[model samples]
Target: MTPRRVTVVGAGVIGLSVAHELARAGDRVTVVADRTAADSVSAVAAAVWFPYRAGASPSMPRWLARSLIRFAELAEDPGTGVDLREGTVVERAPGADRSWTAAVPAAREALPAELPPGALSGVRATVPVITGSQYLPWLAARCAALGVGFSPRTVPAVDELAGSADLVVVAAGLRSGELLDDDSLFPVRGQVVRVANPGITDWLTDDEHPEGLTYVVARRADVVCGGVAEVGSWELAVDPAVEASILARTAALVPALAGQPVLSRAVGLRPGRESIRLEHVPGDAVPVIACYGHGGAGVTLSWGCAEAVADLAGAGLAGAG
Candidate 1:
C-alpha cells in the first residue's frame, strides 16, 4: 500500500494512539498539536482503566474489550507504563453501572471485607492503571520510532491542514469542538492530588461517594487521589478546599494515604460529549476523520479507538484513491 499523508491534531493519548496506528499501517503520519503529550491533560489523568463517564453506545463494549486486551499485553513490558492491578469499585447504590465488568473475565463481586464503609456492593477486578508521566512520553517515543513526525503548533481549524496532508484526524480533546464547529463538545473538569506512595499497590474507586467521586490509584511512583467531575467548568486553578476534601475522602476510603506527603496537584478538563465521535466527516476539502470526545476514557479506550481510526482512515484513503 502506498503511504498516505495523515495529520492528526492533538498530542493527548487519543491523538498519539491514532498517529501510532496510522504510522504503523504505512501512513506518513504527522501529529500537529499546541502542546506535547506530557503537557496535555492526559498527563494529569488518574488513568485507571474503567469506562468512567464513557459515552453510551453499542460499540462501547468492543472498544473496552479491545483496549483491555491491548493494555494487558503492554503490561508484560515495564517500558509501556501499563500495569494490570487488582482493585475494587465501591458501589454505594443499587444497580450502578457494572457494564465494564462484562469485558473483564476476572471481575466478580467483592467480599464484605473488600467493601469500604457505606458501600452497598463492590466489584473486584484487575484493570489497567496507567502512569501518564511515563506512558505519554513512552507512547510519543514509540510513535517517533515508527516515523510519526510531530508538529508543535496551535491549529485553529482542521482546514488549515487540507493542503498539507491527504487525511486529517481531529483528536484535539477539549478544543475539538471549536475546530470542528461542533458545540456538543464540552469540558468535564477533573482534579487530582498526587501523593507519595505508602507501600500501597492496589487501587480503589468510589464513584458513588455522596461528597464527590473518589478514587485512589497507586502507580509505580505515586498514588493518585482524585477527584470530582464538574460539568461545564473551565477553571484551571487548584482549589485548596477541593484538595482537602479529596484527601479526606480518599484517606477515609484507603486509610493508608493519610498523612502521605503531597507530591503535586493538577486540574484537567476532560473532553466530554454525549457520545464519542469516532467516524469520518463527509464533504470536506480534505478527507477528515473525527476521533475526539473521549472524556475521561481517553486512556481506557486509546488502543481500540486508534485501531478504529486507522481502519476508517484506510477506508477513506482507499476511496480517495
Candidate 2:
C-alpha cells in the first residue's frame, strides 16, 4: 500500500485537532490556511464543555459525553498544551434544567447562597478549556515536529487540494464558503471581555437552567471573562454597545467582575449551519472531508468530531477507494 500524505485545510481548532489525531496515527499531515489559525474564529471561541442545552438536540448530549471524555484525555497530556481546569456550572433559578444536569449528572452539586441570588441548581467538575491562542500554536508546532508541513497558501476549492496533498481534509470553519460553495454559511458574532484578576476563582458557566442563561469563565491566565451569542452578525468589529452589554450581563452574574480592571476585548465569529458539515467528497481523486459548521460548540465538540473524521478517513484509505 502506498503511504498516504494528508492535507488539512483551515488550521482552526477543528482542523488542527484533526491533524493532531491523524499525526498521532502516523499519517503525514500538512495544514493549509490563508490566515493564521490563532486568528480564526476557533481562537475567538470561549471554549466550554457545555454541549447543546437539552431540547437543543436529540443526540447532542450523547456526543458531548463522548467528546468530554476525550477532552479530559487530551487535556491531561501536557504535550498537547491544553488548559484544562475544574469548573462549576450553575443553572439559574436552581431547580430548572434538571434534564440537562441529568444528562451530565456529574455536574450537579449544591451551591451556597452567597454565590449568587438566583443560584438555583449547579454542577461542579474539572473539564478542559483550550486557550485557542496557546493550543493552536502548540498543535502547529507538534505537527511540524512530526514532519507535517504548514502551507500559508489558501485553497480556493476542493480541486485545488489535488497534488497539493495526497488526501484532503477541509476544516475551513466558516471560510468554506468559497471551497464548499455554500454562502448560506454565516458568522454568529460574539464579544468577550477578558479581565485579569486574582480574586475571581473557579470555572463557572451560566447555563439557562432556570431563570436565564448568562455567565462567565476564568482563563488559566486569571482572566475572568464573559461572552455573547449574537446570530447572523457579520460585524467582526466589536461595537461599543455590544461590549457594554456583554460586560453588563457578566457583572450581573458575577459581581466580583464588576469594577475590576478589564484587560482586553475581542470579537470572533462562530461559523454556523443548520447542521454540521462533516462529509467525504472526492477532490480530483484525492479524498476530501468537510468539517465545518461547528457554531459555538466547536471548542467542546472538536475532540469528538476529529475522532469521527479520522475514523472516516481511515475507512476511505482501507480500500473501496
Candidate 3:
C-alpha cells in the first residue's frame, strides 16, 4: 500500500494512539494539537482501565477486551506506567451489570466481608491502572520514535488540512464538535485530587457512592482520588468544596487517605455524547474520520478505537488506489 499523509487533530490519548497505529501502518502522520499530553484532559484522568460513563454499546465489549490485552502487554515496560493491579468495585445495588466482567475473566463477586459499609455487593478484579503523569509521555515518546511528527497548534476546522494531507482524523476530544460543526458533543466535568500515596497499592471505585463518584487509584508516585461526574458542566476551576468532599469520601473508603498531604487538584471536561463517534465522514476536501466523544472512557477504549481508526484509514487508502 502507498503511504498517505495523515494529519491527526488532538494529542490526547486517542489521538496519540491513532497516530502510533497509523504511522506503524506506513502512513506519514502528523499530530496537531493546542495542548501537549501533560496539558490535555487525559492528564487529569484517574486512568484506571475500567470503563466509566462511556455508556453501554455492543462495541464496548470488544473495545474493552482489546484494550485490556494491549495494556497487559504494555505493563511489562516500566517506563509505560501501566500496571496490573488487583482492585474492587463496590456496588450499592444488587444484580448490577456485571457484563463488564466478560472482558476481565479474573473478575468475581466479592465476598460479603469485602463489601464496604453501605455497599450491597462488589466485584474484585485485576485490571490495568495507568499513571497519566508517566504514561502520556511514554506514549508520545513511542509515537515520536515511530516517526510521527508533532505540530503544536489548534485546528479551527477539519478542512484546514486539506492542502497538506490526504486524510484528517478528528480526535480532538471535547472540542471536536466545534471543528466538525456538530453540536451533539458536550462535557461531563470530573474533578480529582492527587495526594501522596501512603504505601497503599490496591485501587477501589464506588460509582454508586451516595456522595458522588469516588475512586482511589494508587500509582508509583502518588494516589489519584476522584471524582464527580457532573453532566453538562463546563466549569474548569477547582472547587474547594468538591475537593474536600472527594478527600473525605475516599479517605473513608480506604482510611489510609485520612491525612495524606494533597499534591495537586485537577479538573477535566470529559467529552460526552450519547455514543462515541468513530466513523469516516466523506465529502470533505480531504476525507475526514471522526473519532471522539469517548467521554470518560477515552483511555479505556483508546487502543481499540485506534486500531479501528487505522483500519478505516487503510480502507480509504485502498479505495483511492
Candidate 4:
C-alpha cells in the first residue's frame, strides 16, 4: 500500500512506538511532543512490561502479552535497542483479600532457608522487566529510519493537530486534556528513586511493602526504587518526604541496596482513565484515534496498542473505500 501522511501527537514511548508501527505500515509518520524523547515519562520508567500489576482490567493483560511479544520481535532487530528480560515478581506475603499476586502466582515455592525471616512469605508469578531509557530512543530511531518525521512541539489545542494531518493520534498521556476534552482522564503521580547497584543485577523483592514499594530495572546506569501511586496528583516537584520514605522502604525490601549511592529522584504523571482509552476521539477532525490514559502500563502496552491502532485505522480506511 502507498504510504498515507499521518501525524502523531506526543513523542513519548507510546507515541513513538505507534509512529514506528505506522511507518512500517507504509504511512508517512510525523511525531510531535513537548520535550525530546528522552525527557518523557517512558524514559523515567523502569520500562519493564508488566501490565497486570495494574490489574487485569480493560483487557490490559492480553494487551500487555501482545506488546511483550512484539517487543521481543523488535529486540531481535540488530539495531533496535529494545531488551527482553526474564524476571520474577515475588509475593512476599499474601493479604486478606489476596489483592497483590492472587492473579499471578508462579506457584508455591519453598521459601529459601537462606531467605531472611521476612525475605518472602509466599511466591507469586514472575514476569519480565524492561529498561526504557534505551528502548524509547531506539524506537525513535526506528521510526526515523522508516521515514517517520519528528517534531519538537506541543499541541495546545486539538484543532492544532486535527487540522494539520491526514490522520492524528492523541498520546499526550496526562497532558492530553490540553487538546483532548477527556474528563475521565487525569494524572496518577508516581515517584521513583534510582540507586547505584554495583553488582546487583537480578530482580530483588521490594520487601513487605503494602502500599507503594515496587521494583523497577533501568538501563546501563542502575536500578530504580519506588514509589508512590498518588492518584490525581500532578505535582512534578519531588516531595522530600516522599523521596525519603521511598528510599527507606526500598532499603528495607532489599537490604543489599542499603547504603548504595543515591543517584536521583524522578516524578511522573501517568495518564489514567475509567478504562484505558483506545477509541476514536469522536469530534476530532481527520479521523483521530486515542491511545492514552494507560496509567502505569503505558510502556507495557505499547506494541499491542500500536498494532490495534494501525489495524483499526487500516480497517476504517478500507471500509471507507
Candidate 5:
C-alpha cells in the first residue's frame, strides 16, 4: 500500500513538528509555508517551557506534560538547540494559577532570596529552553531525514491540496483562521530584545511585573529580554519606547545585563484564540486536521500538539483505508 500523503501548512516549530511526527509514523509529508521557522514567530519567542498567554484548553495539561518530556529528551543532544535550565516564575499575587505545576513535578515554591523585589511568591523549576536559531534548522533537518519534503510557497486555501494530499494539516499560525474562515482568531503582539549574554544561564519570568510582562532568558549565544503582550495588535515594527522600557525592566531583573550590548530586537504577532484548535474539520472534501492558535506557548506546546495531530492523522487515514 502506498503511504498516505500529508500536506502541512506553515513551517514554524508547530508545523515542522507535526510534519516530523507524521513522517516518522510512515506518512509522506510535505510542509508548505511562506515563512520558515527562522522567520516565523516561533523564532522570536524566548522559547521557554512555561505556558504564557495560552488560553484554556481541556487537553492543556496533557500537551504541556508531553512537550516537557519531549524537550527534556531532546536536551540530551546539544545539537538539538534545547537545554534543560533552571528558572523562576515570579508571582505578584497570592492566587495566581498554579495549574501548570501539575505538569512539572520538580516545581517548588521559591525561597525568599530567590524571589525578586516586591514579588509575592515564586516557583522554581528546571525546564527546557529552546534556542530557535539552532532548533528550527535542526528540526527541519530531522524532518527531511525522515523523508518529509518542504515547499517554500504560500497556501491560499486548504482545498488546493485536496487533490494531491491524502490529509491536510493546517498549522499556519496567525494566518490559520483566515484560511479556515474562523473569525475567533486574533493576534497577540509580542516584542523582545536580544542582548549579549553576560554569562547568565538561569531564566526568570515576571508575568505580574507592575510595568509589563518581563522575562530574562539566557540562551547559549545571547540572552533574551522581554516583553509586552498587546492584545489585538498587529503592528510588527519595533517600538523605540517599548524597547527602552524592556531594557530598563530587564536590567532591574538581572543587573549583569544592564550594560550589555544590544544584539537584536524582534516583534511577532502570536496567533491567539479562545483555545487551541486541534481536531478534524467537519464536512470538508478532504480530511483536514486543524492545529493552530498556540499563542505565546507555541514552543512550550509544540511536540505535544504535534503528537496529537499525528494521532488524529493516523486515525483519519485508517478510517479512509
Candidate 6:
C-alpha cells in the first residue's frame, strides 16, 4: 500500500492517538496544533477511563469497549502511565444508568457498606486511571517513534492543508467546529485541584452529588480532586471559591485528602456537543475526516475513535485509488 500524506489538526489525546494509529498503518502523518499535549485540555484530565458527559449514542458502546481493551493492554507497560485501579461510582439515585458496566471488567454493584453516606447505590470496578502529566508525553513519544511528524501551527480551515496533503483529519477539540463551520459545538468548563498524594490508591467519582461533579483520582505523583461541569461556559479563570469547595468535598469523600499539600490547579474547556463527530466530510478541497467533540470522555474513548478514524481514512484512500 502506498503511504498517504495525512495532516491531522489537533495535538490532544484524540489527535495523537489517531496519528499514532495512521502512522502504524503506513500513512505518512503530520500533526498540526496550536497547543502542545502539555498545554491541551487533555492535560487537565483526571483521565479515568469511565465514560463521562458523552451523550447517548449506539456507537458509544463499541467505542468504549474497544478503548477499554486497549487501555488494559497499555497498562501492562508501566512507562505508559496507565494503571488499572479499583474504584467506585456513587449514585444518589437508584435508577442511574449502569449500562456503562457492559464495557467494564469485573464490574459489580457495591455492597451497602461500600456506599458512601446519602448514596442510594454504587458500582465498583477496575478502570484505567491515567496521569496525564506522564501519559501525554508517553503517547507523544510513542507517536514520534512511529515516525509521525509534528507541526506547531494553528489551522484556521481544513482547506488550508488541501494542497499539502492527500487527506486531513480535524480533531481540534473545542476549535473543531470553527473549521467545520458547525455552530453546535460548545464548551463544558471543568476545574480540578491537584494535591499531594497521601498514599491513597483508590479512585472515586460522585457525579450525582448535589453540589457538583466531584471526583478523587490518586495517580502516581499527586491526587487529582475535582470538579465542576459548567455547560456553555468558556471561562478558564480559576475561581478560589471553586477550589475551596472541591477540597472540602474531596476531603469529605476521602479523609486522606485533608491537609494534603497543594500541587497545582487546572481548568479545561471540554468540547461538548450533542454527540461525538466521527465522519468523513465530502465537500472539502481534500478528503477531510472529522473526529472531535468528545467532551470529558476524550481519554476514555480515544483508542476506539482513533481506530475508527484510521479505518475511515484507509477506506477513503482506497476509494481515491
Deviation (Å) of 202 in candidate 6 = 0.7
Q: In model 4, how large is the Cα lDDT of residue 258?
A: 80
Give the higher-lDDT candidate: 2 or 6.
6
- Tens-digit lDDT track of model 2 for 1-321: 445789898888888888887887778888888877777877776666665321144545555676777767777776654655667766555355544344355554656753566666667766677666677787778778877778888786788668757778888987876786677577777777777665654667775524233557776664546566667878878777766766677777667777777777888887877777777865355768878787878877777778888888888877645
lDDT of each: 0.91, 0.71, 0.92, 0.70, 0.93, 0.93
lDDT of 3 by residue, 167-211 (tens): 999999999988888899989999999999999888999999998
Cα displacement (Å) at residue 259, model 4: 1.1
Write the residue-wise lDDT of candidate 5 on 70-117 in tens digits: 999999999999999999999999899989999899899999999889
TM-scores vs. true structure, each candidate: 0.98, 0.86, 0.98, 0.86, 0.99, 0.98
Which residue pairs show backbone clashes in model 3? none
Tens digit per residue, CA lDDT, model 6, 238-265: 9999999999999998988999999999
User: Tens digits of per-residue lDDT for model 4 on 1-321?
Assistant: 556778888898779888988889888889888787678877777666665234345566557667766766776764565555544455556552233333344424535742434445444344445666666667777788998998887677766765567788888877776677768777778888888875555554443456465664644467788787778787999998887887777676567778888887788887777677777777766678887877778887888888888887787678554
Give the local distance difference test score of model 1: 0.91
Candidate 4 regions with alpha-carbon error over 4 angstroms: 52-58, 74-82, 92-126, 204-208, 216-219
Clashes of each: 0, 4, 0, 4, 0, 0
Q: Which window of ten consecutive residues has the lowest lDDT sum in model 6?
A: 312-321
List where candidate 3 sits over 4 angstroms from the true fold.
Answer: none
Kindly report which residue stretches of model 6 are placed more than 4 angstroms away from their true locations once superposed: none
- Runs in model 5 deviating more than 4 A are none
